[model samples]
Target: MSDLLERLRGRGWRMTAQRRVVAEVLDGDHVHLTADEVHARAVTRLPEISRATVYNTLGEMVTLGEVIEVATDGRAKRYDPNAHRPHQHLVCGRCGAIRDVHPAGDPLADLPDTERFGFTISNVEVTYRGICPNCATTA
Candidate 1:
């Protein structure tokens, strides 16, 4: 996307072939890829791209809020490209598949005043883990 490239350029980020390939791989709906996965996909377009370059590009994207890093487990962090909107995550516990889901209500509304502990809270992230429909059917 030209908009994404413009934003990155505005932020003083150089657009290299590796970085461009990484960004292209990350662009699409429901894109959740790890650094290695990104590198694998990027190499398809730019065979000279290295794994380290992919990781660096992903880190830059995360820092710029162009992507979201999701830790589904204690293992490698997964990168999500749906950074334009605010939403929660639904993870399949069995297969490690991730999906973006809108909950029924504001989750923060459930937090009581007593839990504030005199500190101002500006944000909250909710992660719901369960077996997805396909996993459930297979089980």
Candidate 2:
């Protein structure tokens, strides 16, 4: 079983066939796939699964804090299953490839007192954009 599946089961999540397939499709490293991409992959494993089911399952997972919905640049939102970890995203400027990057230090602590305008900060999102090695080699 995948980590996401294990976590879901630990949380007493109901494991339906459609939900299982969606979770299975999302199990992997560097897996940042859009809803359509997830639906397409799920169809390969279970042809009867519907797009609505995938979308709804994803929404529920996000609501449960089991998945992260990443919207990079105006493109379709991609779902990431690394919600339990503290990390940032590395985006490929050319192909829009996304990878989970664990960099040293805390971004939340980097903010100075004056930088904050009286609002208490709870979370910080940092995105690093660059041409990935694959894109650089092909260029």
Candidate 3:
């Protein structure tokens, strides 16, 4: 997205071919790609792009709030590009597949009043883990 690039440029980021390729690889709906996976896809378009470049670009995007880093099972972090809206993750325990899900109630409401500990809570992350339909059917 040109708008993303312009925002990046405004943040003093030097636009490079590799960075552009990385951004292109991540632009899509429900895209949850690891750094290595992103590098592999970016290489298809820009053969010269390196893994480090992809990692760096991904980090930059996350820092800019254009991407969100999700850690499932403490394995490789996945990069999610759906940062425009708020949602939580529904993760498949068997295949590690992730999908965005909006739960029924406000997450902040679930926190116990005693647990606030005098700190203002600005956000919350709720991750629901279970066997996905494909995994459950095969079992």
The model with the greatest lDDT is: 2
Q: What residue pairs clash in candidate 3, if any at all? A: none
lDDT of 3 by residue, 1-139 (tens): 5556666678888888888777778887778999999989988999988888788889989989988999877989999888878989999999999999888899798889998999999888889999999999998
- Clashes in candidate 2: how many? 0
In candidate 2, what are the lDDT values of residues 1-139, reduced to their tens digit?
6889888888998899899999999988788999999999999999999989999999999999999999877778899998888789999999998889998999888999999999899888889999999999999
- lDDT of candidates 1 onward, in order: 0.84, 0.91, 0.86
Give the poorly placed runs of model 1, Cα more than 4 Å off: 1-3
Cα distance off (Å), candidate 1, residue 67? 0.8
Q: Taking the tens digit of each residue's C-alpha lDDT, what string does model 1 give over 19-130?
A: 7777778887678888899888888899988877888888989999988898878788989888888878888999999888878888678889998898788877889999
| The 10-residue segment with the lowest total lDDT in model 3 | 1-10
Q: lDDT score, residue 117, model 2?
A: 94
RMSD (Å) of each candidate, 1 decimal: 1.8, 1.3, 1.9
Q: At residue 98, what lDDT does model 3 achieve?
A: 92
In candidate 2, which residue ranges exceed 4 Å CA deviation? none
